[model samples]
Target: MGAATAATYFRILTEGPHVHRNLSTPQLVEAALARGEASLAANGALVAYTGSRTGRSPRDKFIVEDEETRTRVDWGKVNQPFPPEKFEALLERVVRHMAERDLYVMDLFAGADPTYRLPVTLVAEYAWHALFVKQLFIRPEMSELASHAAEFTIIAAPEFEAVPERDGTLSSTFILSDFTRKIILIGGTKYAGEMKKSIFGVMNYLLPERDVFPMHCSANIGPEGDTALFFGLSGTGKTTLSADPLRMLIGDDEHGWGPKGVFNFEGGCYAKCVDLSEEKEPQIFHAIRFGSVLENVVINARTGEPDYSDIRHTENTRAAYPIEFIENAVIPGIGGHPKNVLFLAADAFGVLPPIARLTPEQAMYHFLSGYTAKLAGTEAGLGSEPVPEFSTCFASPFLPLAPRVYAEMLGERLRQHGADCWLVNTGWTGGAFGAGRRMSLKHTRAMVHAAIDGRLAQAEFVTEPAFGLSIPTSCPDVPAELLNPRNAWPDKHAYDAQARLLAKKFEANFAKFDALESIRAAGPRVSR
Candidate 1:
């Protein structure tokens, strides 16, 4: 293909010896099927398997350690440093590796709002990956695509393995981004999420420069045009809670709060499907259809139906489908300024109230802390125990900037909009995971409704001494006792012990955050 047209869209595709331009979804699906990269499941969804690596390899991700990005990024374990020359060499190798192969390319937009949207060109060695991106990002009209220029480019080559020694990489798998060059390189992994997250990372880096606060959250709108933002790390019910049948979903995972309003950073939802039930998550369960891509999900060989309970492949089973797949999704995926911003946590310790209202300072503190429990098996290291982990901004791994960059933006927006903030625990009750019962979805829904409908605001608030959270004395449909953790626990002393331990953990974690003493003081204090 000619370099002029492809290069204008993405320079990386032109650098590659061969470039394929803008293949239709049907054409790409055919190419994927012919190459045996994907197969049609019994349910008519595309079944793709990423051998060995089913989830994102966060440790393998790196940012170019050059003049342009060296000072810009938070360089350490999470944002590892990769030599610019090494990145150049890797790019050359990646380009050459795909030179002889039939490549697939698609140009799409990232942000849904026109003001902040980024034109992205996705270049993939696997046709299925191209189709996946097409579904996961905003598709441009034919006329727009003709003259579309990509602000960023992604070149994914899963078949190309890096040499750790030669490439100066930790392993054969690498996901490196060079902001100065506006290009991202992926190799040695077939997990489609890597591609999805890399684009979000690019936005996380670029948007803040333009004063946009990019978020790892879900957003939705009520009929009265009121908007709400749900912030949480994975396994925290962001997708499930945001997909309310009574509300219109703006987007499920990534979004940007800019001058205009809250806009979806992605065009689709990549929902975790472990133990997903049709009755529990009806919207997500039904969104799996003909064009959906089922990643690492086990399917019955005979029936062709997905066995969501099967962890043989991975606990990180996922489904990727367009946002429109959800029945009540907001077309164009945009929403007004949020009236409420919720910080969701799955507190396995069960010491936190099922729901609590947050002051502005507490909101900033919690937003910065991004505290949540890490369930075992989510990573390689833990046993079946629940461990507390802090992911700053609910997306520390994907954040290229310092935590304060996002936190400060959030505080400013919340104050500017006069938005109410909340902390809701969708975890265990009475005791820790093993000793306690998981909070019922019915009760959680009722509590959220109360928060949104102004019922919780009118209720009497009693401050939880250990956590310094103002828990409501009663909610509309939720029981009075469930509102307070101490009341819910049979042994108040045991609850006090767990509360103290959790408060200490929060203090220790917040010490790492170099913010003003006032913002730091916004955290919890355990009363003796």
Candidate 2:
């Protein structure tokens, strides 16, 4: 069984009496309510719960090691190899399970740009999952839907649990992708993010072959037509910072850098809702309305309002809404080549500069290192404290190919386009997580605006010895002492010790990457 067999199964399922194809938002929401899958919030947003699993199960994800991907895919812990035979069997089981239930199907586009957009078909077992993807992915016009044909299909049966012994899965939940068959199979977990990110993984593998650099970053454009990208992992402020009221947001996450320019890989945003407030993030707060889907957010039973502070379910609560819900979002989500690129790091160790300008080599080094403290609740097994780790290109989980593929592509694009690069630590400051406070959002925003608007370029710079990053002497609307991390720390010796430890971590991580001498030399100056 292969692509042809998979296609035949999908056609049978779609044409079956239990199938509901292309249901509108209202109809899907109604269906979800009737099925008791979700409830309506006071603000009219649909609130759903992902029982047991609140975040992605990376260990459970597998990519088929068929003849097509045998040499192309990077076979390791991240891209775990699943036997082609096992995948076909698992897919058959999932399809059979879905065929017995009321299936909801949605056809959507992944990329905003027509030239590179991927036509996707999602076969879901729940109506809310259909609503979730409908809002998260680009919706086509009525006329376009008439001729729509999916290049890839995702068969998701959340209620259908896999038999680990027979399916070769670590747990009951499984996310299996077969590039040769052009199909993704998901089961056991109801977390809708698996569906969204599976497509992202596909794009990450497909686009680079087409000379397009697929990025896991947020993008926005200024009034002067200058576009900027914010690269970071979840809970790193990529979505919060890019939703600038003054600029038009291209997308919150997932984009492609092609010959035309930067284009959004999604039609909407999936923003973290932990401690979310209108006063802090007005755009995201307001964007949650009638058509949006809120996952695991605690709604007050008495008032029906959402309590963003509640973490009983999980700290990784989320809100998904169309980009148009944001008043300043750019329709079609296309922009000119970025004038600036910022690498965001949540340094829980509190040693990195508040903001620093990166030379091309330094940019490449950090891009490969992609160091950031893994915040709690962002993933399933993470502890409460922020753990320091390097997620290559800030997107190791989604990349099916090797890290070098993305890094080389980024280096080429930055050189050809001459985009300015900066490193901003949106993490802790002064001491560490428990000892020091998180960086001020206002101050971070001021520094970001200064860097992108060309104000910080004229400021004097001092080289930090630990990471060899150029720290600006001053930034408008930011305190002078706060620009340097050592100045804010009460115990300078303690700060130095932490810096040395982090520098060693960087050195150890970079040792594995086979990069140019200059790129390797750009890493931290670890003093033994």
Instruction: Say which candidate scores most in lDDT.
Output: 2
Give the lDDT of residue 378 in candidate 1: 71
Worst 10 residues of 1 by lDDT: 1-10
**Whole-structure CA lDDT of model 1:** 0.89
**C-alpha TM-score for every candidate:** 0.96, 0.98
Task: For residue 234, give model 2's deviation from the true position in Å.
Answer: 1.1
Per-residue CA lDDT of model 1 for 32-53, tens digit only, reads 8999998887767788999988
| Poorly placed runs, candidate 2 (over 4 Å) | 2-4, 375-386
| Cα error of candidate 1 at position 287, Å | 0.9
Candidate 2 weakest lDDT stretch, 10 residues:
374-383
lDDT of every predicted structure (CA atoms)? 0.89, 0.93
Q: In candidate 1, how many Å is residue 74 off?
A: 1.6
